[model samples]
Every structure is written in structure tokens, then in C-alpha cells.
Target chain A: MSNQILIPKLAIVGVGLIGGSLALALKAAGVVGEVVGIGRGLANLEKALELGVVDRITQDPAEGVADADLVLLATPVLTLTEMASRVLPHMKPGAVLTDGGSVKGSVARAIEPLVPEGVHFVPGHPIAGTEKSGAEAAFATLYHRRRCILTPTAQTDPEALRLVRRVWETAGCEVVEMDVEKHDRILGAISHLPHMVAYSLVNAVSSYDRYEENILEYSAGGFRDFTRIASSDPTMWRDIALTNRDALLEMIERFELSLAELKEDIRGEKKDRLYDFFLRSKQSRDAIL
Target chain B: MSNQILIPKLAIVGVGLIGGSLALALKAAGVVGEVVGIGRGLANLEKALELGVVDRITQDPAEGVADADLVLLATPVLTLTEMASRVLPHMKPGAVLTDGGSVKGSVARAIEPLVPEGVHFVPGHPIAGTEKSGAEAAFATLYHRRRCILTPTAQTDPEALRLVRRVWETAGCEVVEMDVEKHDRILGAISHLPHMVAYSLVNAVSSYDRYEENILEYSAGGFRDFTRIASSDPTMWRDIALTNRDALLEMIERFELSLAELKEDIRGEKKDRLYDFFLRSKQSRDAIL
Candidate 1:
């Protein structure tokens, strides 16, 4: 790799788990000329610096991205649009601007109009995370062996797309490209629907008047697995649920149909139907592993 | 413990994962005078003897339990009632009979009438298992640090209950006693309901046509967690759902209500409501950990 392309100066906003981890990975690979961290909270910025995730901390997004060759918007999806608008004015001419947002369609719409004529914008989502959040929870290896999806609009610059792909690839993620709308629908089926199921499963057990004691005692049975997914960041998930409402509703409708069929099998004591579903589902999991 | 009490002659029916595991643990602990394994299949019997899970193998339940002081019914729930009935007439008069069934209420009712006057019948469930099944999957440490619930009827002998508890405790489980009805309800809420939800979630994604490929590719986002649970033994789970129909149905109703509320929140774009539910659910997970 050319030194100029390898050691590009980068600015990361939010400086939380995703952003902090990106900085650490870039620095560890010796691909970062300088990593400027920006966040609303001073404590988080300080923590990122102490963890060696970033070379400098800045409260102002403009100052953070002032001279950077690439700027990554790593804030919550709810704030990504506004944050992109705020930082667009300060980005260096021809610098590529990208985001790490869960949902890409709305984000692409939100940032496209605000970007300077010379700057390129790409929307990306790294399909990896933990139940815990914050800068302290980040590590250099967070993105290793994970998948990162990049969604670029028709007008997106090819060079900008390549640069973003290279960044994630160098961070040890397998990079794939797809259309924004298609990405949203796919993520809704695989990610959003599962989270909804987990949250609902927890709510079902908690709703029972006398279940609290027994639930805690016998949780090892199976409920504990759902709880781990249900324990994800509340604000992030809430934003996802609202933003991907159409796809989520459609998925939920299909889920209800399946649930009803299962209930019928149980009600009618149809062991064969239950057995077939269970065995088939297990094969899918085995394929994944 | 006295040698007579600690090393009682044992007979294990079915000789699959649970049965083989029990025999292995007993032998490892030197807590059994001898272990006689009984199953319908000659192959399984040969495998059990080859693996040393049992000291001897027998095809006849009558001959297997004839000389044993402790008989363990570790077969599937569908076969428990019939097998117990078959072996009851041949079991020693003072022998203790117990089962490892997921649902307790039905098992207790099925075997209660068939048990002999002097022989003790205690229905139990060890809340421990892996996705894998069969004798090949058996391990002596299967029940280590796991919870085992013994659901004995009021007529169960005190001495028999004590001996049953001691056996499970020796196998490295925390033993608790509960009414058969309560055990069924509790297990339904925690284990049965969660498994059903996981199956529903997987089916939901599998039904989507447009984005199926993408969904499978990005399953690591969160969907993969549910797949592992959904991949459990189909025959065993189907039996559980059918035998515990009432309790499972009650839980399904509660889950649907909760899910509908969540759907409404998403459709209405109620961020705060979704956030609050996620936060509350996350708190419960933290408590579990």
C-alpha cells in the first residue's frame, strides 16, 4: 500500500464503542496519520484518549474534521443526520464523509443534501456489537472477522467508496456493498425482528403476577438466552424500531403467523409438526456454524 | 455416607444422553454398586457398554430393574408413562423410581396409578442439556452447577425423596423440591415459551423472499443467537409443547399481548415507550447475570 493512502488522517465523531474501536484498529495497523476524537461528553473523549484509541480530543466537530482526509460519523442513528449536517461545512475539500449507522436509507437522505460539492458521502454499518457500550468497552479487535456493509447512492464517488472499503478491510472486517433500501429490509429480517422477539419474550415472563421468583430460579432453562439480546442499548434499539417501522411491522406480521401455527400444533397435540419445525430450524443453525 | 446407601445398585432406562450421563456421573463418583443400562435398541446398548456409561446392558426393563434399589427413567416424555408402567411390576418392592422429564404434571399423573404399593415414584427434571442429544453426547459433567427440580407428589415416601435428592446432589446439581403443577408452569414460562419464540423468529426470517440471502449473510447481528436455541431437539420440544399445552398456551397469549404493544409503539413512533421497555428488559438481564 502507498504510504499516502495507508496513513490517511481520520476524524471520528461520538468516540463511543464503535468509534473508539475503529481508532484503535487504525492506529494498531499503522494506517492512521492522526485520529481526532469528537464527542458531546468530555469524559468519553478523555477516556478514548487514555485508552490510546485517539491521538487528540476535540469538543467541536468542525475542529475535529478540519484537516482530516476522511471523517467517520459514528454517533447514534437518531443524531447522525444532524451531526453530518453540522460537520459538512468544516470537512476538507475532497475529503470522504461516511457514517456507521444501523439504518442507511434515512441516513443517506439526511446527509446527501448537506455535503459540500467536493466532499463524497457513503453510509456504512458494521454488523458487530456487544451488549455493553461506551469508549471503555471498545477494543482494537472488535471488528476482526466481522462483516461491514457499505451502502452508496447512485451519485456516490467510486473513489470514495473504494477508500471506505479499504478502511474497513484493513480493520479486519469482510466488506460487502449493497443498496441502502435492500440493506434496510435485510437487516430488518435478521437483526430487528430478533431483537423485537427477545424484548417481547422478556415482557411475557415479566407480565405474569407470580412469575418473578420462579423465572429467576429456573432461567437456565432457555429464557436467559433471549435476555442477553433484550439487554442491548435502549436508545439505539428504540431508534431502530422507529426508523425501520415498515419492514419491522411486516416481519412481525409474518412472525405472528408462525407463532399461531406453533400454538395450533401445541393445542392440537401435533407432535410431528413441532418436530419438523424444530429439526428444520436446527439444520439452519448448523449451516451457519 | 454408608457403602450400602452410597453404592446402591442402579438401573437406567433409555440409555441416551440423560441416562448415559447419569450412569457416567455415578460411576465417576463411585456412588453406584453397579449400573445396568436398558434400551430397545441393541446398538445403543452396545454403545453404552463400550463407553463404560453402564457396567452391563440389558434389553429387558423387567430384568434390568429387578435387582436394582434405584431405577432412573431417563427416556423421552412420550415414553415415560408407558415405560414406567412396564417396569413397575418388576421393580423391587422398596426401590425408588424417578424420571427426568421436562414436564412434571403429566408425568406424575401418568405414572402415579401404575406405581406399586411399596415402590416410590418421584418425577424430576434436571434443568441442564445441550443442543446435541444421544449417548454419544453424554458427559459426566453435564449437570455440573445446574439446577435440578424434583416434583414429588404428597404420597411420595420421605426416605425415597431423600435418596433421590442425594443422587442429584452428588451429580453436581442444586436440588429443589416443588409441587408437580408449579414445576410445569414455571418451566413453561421460562423454557417452553422461549423456545417457541425462537422458532417463531427463525420462521419469520425464513418466510421473507426478497431479502433472504442478505438476511442470512448478516445474521450475526443478533439473529444467530436465537437460531442456537431454536435448533434444539425437535422430538423432545414437540413433546414438551404438547404435554404442557395449557401452560404453554397461557404464556403464548401473554407474549402476543406484549408483542402487540411493542408493535403499536413502533408504528406510532413512540420512542420513549420503546426505550423504556428496552431499558426495563435490560435491567432484568443484568439481574440474571
Candidate 2:
């Protein structure tokens, strides 16, 4: 507590919004020293350095995470395991490794085995982000007041778990622990399903074939705001869809059943039923927001 | 251009967010000498008066529209015809009668016949509003830089059309004239369909039956913003669903088809197809926004 930094050398791979923001947040909290930004995109890594998001930048995975106290993989979910395999061999024995992907169970199952003898793997998801990408979208307050779920198994070391929790808490997140499977299911219902719906809805309007070009222009604020999530990174969401396929498929089926019932209510001109249907959704949404 | 007001007296039935906002905008523009708020809810009517959204309040349709230079029916789409019938007899000769309902073809078909010999009917829809309702949600800038579409048929008076266009322009709307059926079709594709999708999606998440109580709490900003439209007034949306039934049903069918394709793509892990699907929507949305 006297003058020692919590993380003497922290490595952040991927260095986009989530990774860059975490480095900025940890630096702002003064809990991390010698932050290193690593990514395939040299431009983004350089920008992160130029913007003071990191103390150094690197394109090589081994060069980035070697000798670091903590190495965080913040790439798209599907790439996390491969990136881990590349960097784990070179990381220090006691260094803690984690990620900020939306899907957790698959990541935990795939990467837990790749952890070196003395290294620790803690799969985490910071329940935050905008429909934005790149280092320019990064900000120190991106994770403030947001929830961060860490999925730790029996193999997770207690010290590594505490350190990971401290890192997120210092970045202003309310960190919670849960089993990885339950995290995927809950996130599948809330986050994955909604993104699918938005994506599908926008695609629907675009391909309506009635009057294609100008239909979206007539969209009011409701439509514009509703479809904002569809603008998120395609590769990231596609990976989430693939990684959490079972849970997402289940959620999609449930949603289709609900939509079918409401469609029938509208088609039959069941005024009372329609009113009750909308009233229930309104009440439910109102309770949430 | 003299010191005379554009509309000596204006009567707005169903004084909710839309009607109240119009009144406030016109009053702020100093174009209406007096505004009358009429609705079944006396509390909202009084709130409109207190907020200076209107100069007077009335429950009786006859007393509200009598001797007014302009009468605007801003109620739900389904109730516009019945309201028009109730107030048609009391409106002074040469007075303009318009509405702020979302659907226009059905309203025009039903209400145009009820217009008194000397009265003029112009069906207008200002493409603006928020999820909030009632007079308290009214604001003068609600319509600024928004679009207002007036569907005027052959029976519509030239003077009445001019006056309605002027009123919307004064409220900072870019007024456009279109056929009633085309307006309904365009709005059905954009506004009504999106509302229905949001309503159905919220219902879907609430009824998932997996982890009902805590699922929504885990929702990130994307899910919350995506479902915000579901919190709109149920009765108003119900009326919209019923009145714009055909076009909305068609749009729903198209949406279901689009969703089914995306669902299949996810289930099969068609990475290229999924990426392309999302890319298409993102490009379409980016173009619009």
C-alpha cells in the first residue's frame, strides 16, 4: 500500500475499445505500471500509444506479455484461445491471464488447459461497450458503474482470482463471480438475443422489397435507437453467436414463438388480446429501465 | 403579415404528448392566439393548461371545437373517426380539421365523409414523438427539424392544406404532401413495424421462462435501448396495430422470413453468411444514420 504498483507490468492484447479503455482506466487509477498495447493492427497499437492509452506498443504476442504481471486478451471471442496459445508460452510463471469477451464458458473450457504450470486463467466479461470500435472509441470511464462477471473454475488460483477482481474494481466495475455456463445462458437471453433481433430487424426492413431505398428514412427515433446495436462489430458478434450457439439458438426459438403469438393477435384483430400483449411488454420493459 | 394570429383559436383533442407538443410549439411560435386542450383525462387537460401548452381545457368535443379556426385531432388512429364525427357539427364553417395520427389512409377513408359541408379535412402526421406520454412530456422543440406528412385527397380544400402546412412549418417541420396509402405503407415499414418488433422482443425476453426475474437485470445498454420502444403507450400502439393492420402484417411476415434466415445461418455456423448479413445491415443503417 505504501508505493508499490498493484500491477508492475500489464499487457493488453487486441488494444481496441475494450482493451484500450482498460489500460487507460488502470493507468488513471495509478494501479498499473508500464502498460503495453498489443494487436495485429500496428496502426491501432500506435494510436493507443499516441493517445497515452499505453506506455508501450507491440505487434508480437510474446514480446507484449513476456515478464508481465498480468496479461489480458481483449480480442473477439473466437480468437481468444489461439491468442492465448500464442502468448501463454512466453508469459511469466506467476503472471495472471484474463480476457474481456462477452462469451465465457467456451473461452474457459478452451483456454484453461493452455495455461502454463504456474500461470492462471480467469475468463471475464465486462458488461459494457458502445456500438463503436478502434482505440479512438476508448475512454477511461467506459467501465465505470458497469458489471463485470468473472467465471472461475476449480483450477483458478485464489490469488489470481483476487488480483483479477481488484483490477476490474479499480477500473470502477462491480465485479461478481459466477459459473461460466450460467453466465452464457443469461447473457445469451439478454445480450445475444437482442443483437440478433436488431440485426434481423434491420435486415428485414432493408430487404422488404416493397420500396427498399427510402423505407429506412421514414424511421422515427424509435427505429433509429432500436437498431443502434446492429452497428456493432460484425466479427465480434458473429463470434459470440458461434461460441454461445446453443444458448443463442434456444433464445431465438423462444423469441420466434412469442412473435408468432403476437402476430396472430394482430392478424385476428383481437383488440383486448393485443392491448394486453403490449401492456405486458410495456410493464416488463418499464420495470427494467 | 400583420399583427393578427395565424390561427385565432386552435382545438386539440386527446391532448397527450403529440398534441400538447404541437400546442406548445405553436404557442412558442406566437402563431396561435388561443389553444384548447380536450381529452377524457381531466388531469392531463389541467396539466396542459398549467404548463401553458393550452389556454383552455374542455372534455366536451362540441365545446372544444366550436368557433375554432383550426381543430387538430391528435388521438390514437382508431379513435380519430369517432372523434371527428363528435366534433364535426360544432366546428365553424371554413375551419380546418387535421390529425396527428400515424395511419392516414384508414383515417381519411372514414373521416372524410363525415366532414361537414363547409369544413375542410387534411390528414397530417408529424413524424416525431417520444415514449413518454401525457401533457407533462410536451416540449416546444419536439418537432424541430422533423418531418410532417399531410395526406390530402381530392376532397381536401386548398386553403386548408396551405394552413396545415404553415402550422407544421411554424412548428419547425419540413412539410411534405403524399398520398394517404403511400404514407401508411412507408410508416408501416418504418415506424409501426419497428414498434411491433420491439414489443414482441420484450415479450420474448420476459417469457423466456429460463431465468425470468434476473435475466433483464443482466441486460447491457444494447438490450435496454433496443427495447425502449416497447415502453410506449400500449393503447396507442394497439390502435396503431389495428388501424394499420394490412401493411403491418405484411411487414411482419417479411421480418419473420429475414429472421429465419439469420437463425439458420447461426445454427449452421455459416461464418461468411453471418458476416455478410451483419455487414449488409450495418452498411444499410450507417447509410441511413
Residues A74-120 of candidate 1 have per-residue lDDT tens digits of 88889998889889998888898898889888889878988889999
Model 1 chain B: which ten-residue window has the lowest total lDDT?
A: B1-10
The stretch of ten residues in a row with the least summed lDDT in candidate 1 chain A is A1-10
Task: Report, to 2 decimal places, the DockQ of model 2.
Answer: 0.84
Residue-level lDDT of model 2, residues A1-289, one tens digit each, is: 1235899999999889999999988888888879998899888888888999988988899988888999999999999999999999999989999999999988999998888898888889999999999888999999998999999999999999999999999999999898999899989988999899889999988776665456787777778898999999999989999999999999999888988988899999999999999999999999988
Give a tens-digit lDDT track for model 2, residues B214-274: 5788777888899998999999999999999999999899889998999999999999999
**For model 2 chain A, the run of ten residues with the poorest summed lDDT:** A206-215
Model 1 docking tier (incorrect/acceptable/medium/high): medium
TM-score of each: 0.96, 0.98
**Native interface contacts retained, candidate 2:** 0.80
Whole-model Cα lDDT per candidate?
A: 0.85, 0.90
Docking class of 2: high
| Clashing pairs in model 1, backbone N/Cα/C closer than 3 A | none
